[model samples]
Target: MRANLKTANLKSGDLPGDVTHHPYDAYGLPLMVEPASPALAKDPLAVQSWFAEHHRTLEALLPTYGGVVLRGFAIPDTMAFNAMIQCYDTDPNGYAGGLTPRKNIAGKVFEASRVPADQKIILHQEMGYLPSFPKMVAFYCLKPSETGGCTTIGDMRRFQKQIPANLLDAVHERGVLYRRNYRAPGPVSDPLVALFRREWTDVLQVETVEQAEEACRAVGCEAVWEDDGSLSMRYRSSGFVNHSVTGEEVWFAQVQGMHFNQARLAQNYDTLNKAFPGGRPRPIEILFGDGGDIPEDMVTPLYDILDRLAVNLPYEHGDFMLLDNIYTAHGRQPFTGSRDVQVGLVF
Candidate 1:
């Protein structure tokens, strides 16, 4: 194992089995962890020990690095991956009221978003729009895509700096309001039903609309029943937040991800336009806290900044990545073939 002068004091014993760290020159110096010894890569127990020995140093590096990619570990299955995560954080968060459609694998581990491979998910902090969110998010690659399924990450600090100063000030002063419409599932012949396959019951995990409303209220959202028995909810949240450890201001909202103009929502628009002669309202919308429309001109520049700052991290089978949720924003690139990634959250 090579000695790291910065973390030399934190070293416990001669690092087990030749693990190596590589630093990247992105917005934050993101680290890449790899095994130098082939035998070490195949042994989950040895990797777990290595992580435990350097736990303190890893925690300290997170604020500066934003995240780390642990490759060549050959984590065998969900059980082994969960074991590795427990080394850093024992408390795993369950996926409740999560926007994406995912199935739990074991304990708190889940299949990553089941969105179509052709869709490109926009960059945003994980569940940043919610009243509560995990402090850290980790992804384990069980199977890598044959082509184009890189997980793109953006440094929140850099994104904050790159955006327009006036827009940033406006968001800070007014915050943001998120609106979502959930319709009931029905025959595909119905346009609205086809558009939003997810029903309110599925999202709230409740049998009744009253229970759904109560659940919304618990999460600080205002819920109203539409004339067609659909549920509409609005949540107000800050566009920026302070990093839990460093207290640095970070761009932490779902503006780009939920915005209609973004590529991620392009398919929704197409479906809606085809169903209705006139355009249908966006299922999700982001507005200024005062309910004022966020100018498209302002949003355009932020998208540009995100594009400029994003770093694409392609996955290899058995690769694992841990991200400081407040410091980094993540997304997915459009891919072909099968891509199986699992996620676990640390709260």
Candidate 2:
């Protein structure tokens, strides 16, 4: 432990300079750290220096709190955000076989997600479907939308504790299977198809089916090429994962989002269902590890659980947040106007 700094239960005026700490909510979700003085708030370099000195303390707190929010510092741009994370001396992680549409914008930084503004991104641990995933995920907000674009977070350990014992047992016994079908290269005529579909090349960051298969295999997924030029990949993973540092079992799966539950898809479900046969040709399908159908009854309860525990964090320009990927689940809320958030993954 660093001298004069404690890992847990940090409070205002505990650290040097004008920086102070406070709980974002009753849950202590993103232990909000900010400069109490106006001069320090405007000086990005000062904020950077402070973070560099106390990063280890923040790191220690992650397993307990799941995330930390650095507010009031005007971080300026993506490059600065990259610099802040680099203060911890972690290398930039690549997003290979990623599902969301995002473009790399700066060194080790990418636009958060390219989904339509009105769409609600369901809560899930980043890259939870993969065999290996980042230990930490950082998000920097360049701009907040005019309305309703909060980046939501949920504590997975809390969620795991709240999940009914029978449901937890079922998850542990059956595990989870995620199947993704990347569309063949072509223009999609249907708006619904356009919203849900991604080309294999876009997902794997490769031009050839062979390369895509190799990439999928590297990540413990079984890949197959369909005659129609579509690509399908399947992966089996435990519905719960143990936290890397704390060794606590936590809810760490994307089943709800990948399943595209009726509550989430709403009226679009019927249209999408009709557009794609058996919904097999859609972006992805989530099922039991044995390839059994995941009934709505099993998945809907999770939505309710997450909703009850969610912390809808409204972003301010220059706000940066770091999440312990294994301990936290994050999502996006629908919004209007311009919203720009960049993300970085670190192990």
Alpha-carbon RMSD to native, per candidate? 4.4, 3.1
Model 2 lDDT-worst window of ten:
1-10
Give the C-alpha lDDT of model 2: 0.78
lDDT of 2 at 164: 72
- Per-residue C-alpha lDDT of model 2 across residues 1-347, encoded as one tens digit per residue: 12122344554334556677877878788788887877657877776777788777777777667788988886988777887877443333267677777777877787887888888888888877777777888899999999999999988878888777766787799999888888877787877666677888888888886888888887778997777788888888988776656556777768678875677678788887787767454577788899877777777787888888889988998998988888888998999999998898776
Which 10-residue span in candidate 1 carries the lowest summed lDDT?
A: 8-17
State candidate 2's TM-score. Answer: 0.90
Error of 1 at 125 (Å): 0.3
Off by over 4 Å in 1: 1-18, 26-29, 37-39, 87-93, 262-281
- lDDT of all predictions, in order shown? 0.73, 0.78
Q: Cα RMSD (Å) between model 1 and the true structure? A: 4.4
Per the 3 Å backbone cut-off, how many clashing residue pairs does candidate 2 have? 0
Q: What is the per-residue lDDT of model 1 for residues 1-347, given as tens digits with 9 covering 90 to 100?
A: 12233543442133334777766654544688788877658888887777767655665567767887888876877887877776444233255456777778886688888888988777888877677777878899988899999888888887877778778889899999887777764445675755454677777777877788888876667887777677777888888777666556787777777665534345566765454332333466788889887876777777778888888877888888888788888889989998888988777
